[model samples]
Target: MSIRQLFRMGMVTVALLGALPAAATTQLRVDLSQLSRDSDAVIHGVVRRVESRWSGDGRRIVTDVEVEVKEPLKGQPGGTVLVTQPGGQVGDIGQVVHGLASFKTGEEVVIFLRKRGTQAFRLSGQAQGKYQVVREEAGKPAMAVPEPSEALLLDPVTRQPSTVVEKPRTLAELKAAIRAALTEPAP
Candidate 1:
């Protein structure tokens, strides 16, 4: 092949590589008991607003989610909380961290959070900590649905493929499990 043709082919290959998405992140999938035990707060809330911006160092993007607290299941009294998470869009630029949790405005959720500062929190276990509240029909009981994570999940203790099954639970049932997990003696 001509040198010019080889150069053009190389340029096209580099462009395609740049456009490819990053590999999926790996995370340890924690059970509900572990999530309840490790979290500083468990909140049932509606996402009031979401904003993404560059981090303090201007090296990466972070998203701030303002949640209007509907109930405080395992923390102090109900109020607004700002949850900061990694990865988001800043203008025309964007980033997606595959294992991180995401939120939408006006969506109801039950989130497990670790206290970061005054009324500030972070997700307890990446996508495993956020649950979307959904109902099949009007007036029907709502179910807490765990985020459908794209990450390769491993068991925390064994470091092997996670055996934990994620399934939706009624909101009431989820709350009770959290409470029960909290009250159980630590192992």
Candidate 2:
């Protein structure tokens, strides 16, 4: 009931709220091979091409996509890599699945990608740019936004991202949890 007590309580609330993202940081520890399936994820890359094709059911649909590597996708061309996925969506739900629309050739955009199997990556929507495509070095693809370097709850971890979630209160403890989340194997 005292003013000092209320102020302390408010500060604690704010601090906890800020930690929510980190504390809730969940990573899917799937086998990198899982990247080869129809699984979905957010992909960042440039749009290289588009195709209007038919699905196995022979339904008329557009499969628009191109190659997009992860930011600094490691010793690879940083341009559109031909790809495709379903389109049309509205929100966080879209992030949860495939993109909401098809991409266009030469459009610099970030996509939420899913692997169609152990073969290649698929598009989830006609994604938008998550980074500013600026070439960091000559003779190299443009630079994209640096990934957050965190974890996704859907990442299929074999173990939990954090083991100390008994609720860490210190920065050091939180960081340890994050490291564990990153290194721990996913189921």
The whole-model lDDT of each prediction reads 0.90, 0.42
| lDDT score at residue 185, model 1, on the 0-100 scale | 99
- Candidate 2, residues 1-187, lDDT tens digits: the string is 9999999999999999887645223444332223212224444456556655555575435464555564432223334344645432332222222323334566555433545554445533123212234445666544443123233333244554433212212323323333454455653
lDDT of 1 at 50: 99
What's the TM for model 1? Answer: 0.84
lDDT of 1 at 29: 83
Best by lDDT: 1
RMSD of 2: 12.3
Q: lDDT (0-100) at residue 67 of candidate 2? A: 58
lDDT of 1 by residue, 77-107 (tens): 3688899988999999998888888899999
Clashing pairs in 1: none
